[model samples]
Target: MFVKSEYQKKLVHVKDVLSMINSGDHVVSGLAGAEPKAILSELHTAADSLRDVSIITCLPMGNYEFFGNPQYKDSFLMEGWFYSGFMRKLHANKNITFIPNHLHFASTKRLDYKVPRIYMGNCSPVDAHGYVSLGLSAVYEKDMIEKADLVILEVNPNVPRTFGDTLLHYSKVDYFVEADYQMPELPVTEPNEKDKLIGKHIAELIEDGSTIQLGIGGIPNAVAQALKTKKNLGIHTEMFTDGMVDLVECGAVNNSMKTIHPEKMIAAFALGSKKLYDFINDNPSVEIKKGTYVNDPYVIGQNHKMVSINTSIEVDLTGQCCSESIGVRQISGTGGQADTAIGAQLSEDGKSFIALYSTAMIKDKTTGEIIEKSKIVPMLTPGAIVSLSRNDVDYVVTEYGAVSLRGTSVRERVKRLISIAHPKFREELQKEADALMIW
Candidate 1:
């Protein structure tokens, strides 16, 4: 009986792996922090020989040559589920496309429509049992790998070995490429005075032992900082970050009262600095699961006192939130905002909060002058996409105050939202509301 080790059999050069990728094959890369840089770079280098190859990804962190140069457009096309700053710039290209989806069903919907031919991602070194962990991100990688015909892994020692639904046996992977690239870091946001005020208002609404779901950015970081004094807070978020790590260290989040996955920080993915990676590496306190379960409204609602804190770019008086876009321009995708907002509201004692600055400084298109305008408007800009409908909003918080919109009439919502607007814009907003006959 001759049985060779799978690792030796699967180990191949980057060019060799690229040679396996046929033209017109659908390729799905890993999500966020788990993206396979080496393999992707090789794919870009070999792009001249391929044609109509589609590269599908979500929130890709680094600036890769493949996406940086537009010359490969004839051979490759890029599709994003959620746009990063780099991807947003690439939107000028006609070949790039965006897929609108809720976070929970992102993988399932794509799979149902078209199963990918190749799945490439980064993973931790093989463990004693020949199992590799999908480190940092498990969002849709698990589902994509299962559906793809060929699975390729970039073995990176720097990637943390996380537990839960991300482990895979060596036999499952068709090829391997060793890589030693530095993991991308998401810096900690310093909360300004306005952010601090908003954080304080949001923190007041959260009681001790509440299960919280927080997205990334300055506002969520501010909220987490505000909750430092609370006790027994549990984390059930879609993306865990450095702020959550701080909460856990401060003894504010003990995960003691969660109805689901009690005593464990439950998340589908993580993106942050090296410290966050070190914290979750082989740490039994953290459990990274699949996005299908982590972001499911039904699953999130099962937790007691679930409080979801998210941010919005602009909000209308009627409670419609434009979080994913600026007017008709797509700044980002609708990533778990609707899911967590509605799910937290579905809980027995849950509350969902949409927080943003009361006003924004925008440059006048005609005059090229920067002007301060109200973000709480009478109506959303024409062509704006509503990430969260009026019916799903529970609490709307600004630096001025926080107002509950749940079960409120249109007139009542207008008044409540107006009270929290920037003092300078209150009068103008009132006049607009009057003209619209909303109050």
Candidate 2:
């Protein structure tokens, strides 16, 4: 079904198109699990050839070594939606730009117009009938091709043929580059001693038949691992990794009680192992959609028993959630954490939880060196973004225990939050709490 057209008939290396890119060109790529490595490799080669080649990406995974060097600073610039391990270095570098947007808007906002001239993406190899799948990032790339001036489709045999908004006709792709490579599998952080204890406590709070929204990280993954025996659990999350696979296989997550989408798992995106990708392939049980719909606080509130469990870098005695930044540094962004937090609060039987360790890294006077410090700051740094306001937060979970903050007095909120603070700093936190007289 390869039509013989000028742009469609070309059998060129992925690098060749990347080499043709010039300044003022906005280049978009499939971020996270579906990154086109071959095209990226070629783009690196053309770093010096192009000027002001603005590359836009979201939740991108894999090595971004080329973007780090100062030599290519003038040639190419990068922007990220969520900071991955590779893009974390960009926060320190001035050349790179950072945009705080939800995952759903990552592709929709750019693809609805001609801002991005070139679209770099990966897809499952054409099937016997010549159809390719968007693999892990269908929600973003589907709209990219519709709007981009040029679409470079990498046909990787290893990309899973996932279902829901994944199918791409051969005629849609402008250039096809044949490549076979394995999708990257990020190793899940093994639950540490603290994580396991926290996980166990969180697991006990989750009841059977509850609709769950979990954030990414070791604690969330551990919490999922601890709930394998709980029955009839439903997932209505913004994103999920390999941890949910085991729960689904073991019949722990049956999606039976969810009022929104019965018997189907709903999410904005998927990022995990090949098995998770393959499991979603052509699977009618999954619906991948935009963040406006998937992460809408109002829409999530429609579901029954919505349990949103998100993390935080720190929490103030006043119950403010700081998830986007660490003190002054912008390490992450306000993702669907607040969206789901509010959703859980609005659900008739729902509960929103901000879970975190209650300490920061600091120096000890006795030891003459820094050690685990308290993250329960008395007050947020001036101008710090309060992602989850006091009205939005319902529960704060720590290894110490869960503190319910909904409808609690300001004084009570401080008392409850400080109660769970690290022992070394509890008295100091209490002293600050008393001085403020936050009641």
Candidate 3:
């Protein structure tokens, strides 16, 4: 419709684009569903011709061989901001390592370390006026594309065209590789009985007209179901999932009472079911923004009665939460756990919640027996990294009950947290706390 012929000159096959890659280049792939599968899937075919190429990825949807297979270690090294199962399983291969960052500063921090040589992502077909939508994610893709030596995008008709900062002029992108594929989808995670109990407790804490941020998991979905009866809720989050779609369809999230961006849902990126993609297609009510602004504490604090809900792997008596690790083993990334928690606290009358199960089942290494271990402990596992510090924790919920620790003293926090732990481990935790003289 607008300058179509002018942009068509830049079209190229995926193999031709791969020829531009050279040794010692820094390649950045799109986030989540925005990943350019056609280009990435064939990257390894050219790997034998290159050497020492570094790649930066965030929440990759598919496991491309460049980083997934240890055999390609000599030619490519993966530096990820966040990891999926494929990357985590190959972490010990020595070709992949985590690049620690907060969601808001992921792009900025990386550029400070090394500028990108190439930026690749998925986008909707060019529209009238010579513009293309970045589609599913804006998280940090836009930031990388801005300064990369080359910009190549997979033009997929199946990608949902979204609004806000997801648009880019055709002239800015170097090449367009035609693609025909369905966008990746994640099915809804059904909540278990324990998830429902924790969800109900959290639902009771939220007031009407409140805005909320939800992380990925059954607990968040349960929270979504629990909030179905609420009126005029709003969404301002890092990752928008299908649960939010359910809330909107149910009329619970009208966004009418938001203090900022009223009547619209704001997010950095989205991931979930095919239904979720269709709901956001050309939807003016949904805005896909950059992670720098969406996850910023000051920006997130502008919402009315903001509520941040997230999950954890384990929590200690003093309110420290190890969410992304098991001892020294990395499971995920810090993501926006601290960002949203602090931002919600900054909002007037806003609240942040951390939820988890009371206990976990573990096999005893020495006796070969299965036992129930408390997720609530006097101290974190020896090498566990603290995802959320004690100062930022607000409310914590478990199947047994919920506890609030805002402005609470150390001794009081110990008591409150232990009270909500599984009954079988309460006394054991108390003795550990006393022996350490931590409270």
Per-residue lDDT of model 1, residues 83-143, tens digit only: 8888887777665778999999999999999999999999998887788899988889999
- Predicted structure with the largest TM-score when compared to the true one: 3
lDDT of candidate 3 at residue 67, scale 0 to 100: 82
Q: Mark the 10 consecutive residues where model 1 has the least summed lDDT.
A: 1-10
In angstroms, the error of model 3 at 133 is 0.5
lDDT of 3 at 80: 84
Q: Quote the lDDT for 411 in model 1.
A: 92
lDDT of 3 by residue, 1-439 (tens): 4687777798999899889999999999999899999988988888889999888888787888888788899989988888888888888999988888889999998989899999999899988778899999998999999989999999999999999999998899999999999998887889999999999999999999999999778999999999999999999999989999999999999999999999999999999988999999999999999999999999999886999999998999999999988898887899989999999999999999999999999898799899999999988989998999999999999998889999999999999999999999999999999999988
Which order, best to worst by lDDT?
3, 1, 2
lDDT of 2 by residue, 5-53 (tens): 5334745786677766877898888867767788776566777667888
Model 1, which residues run further than 4 Å from truth? 1-4
| Best of the two (1, 2) by TM-score | 1
Residue-level lDDT for 83 in candidate 1: 89
Predictions in order: lDDT = 0.91, 0.77, 0.92
The window of 10 residues in a row where model 2 has the poorest summed lDDT is 2-11
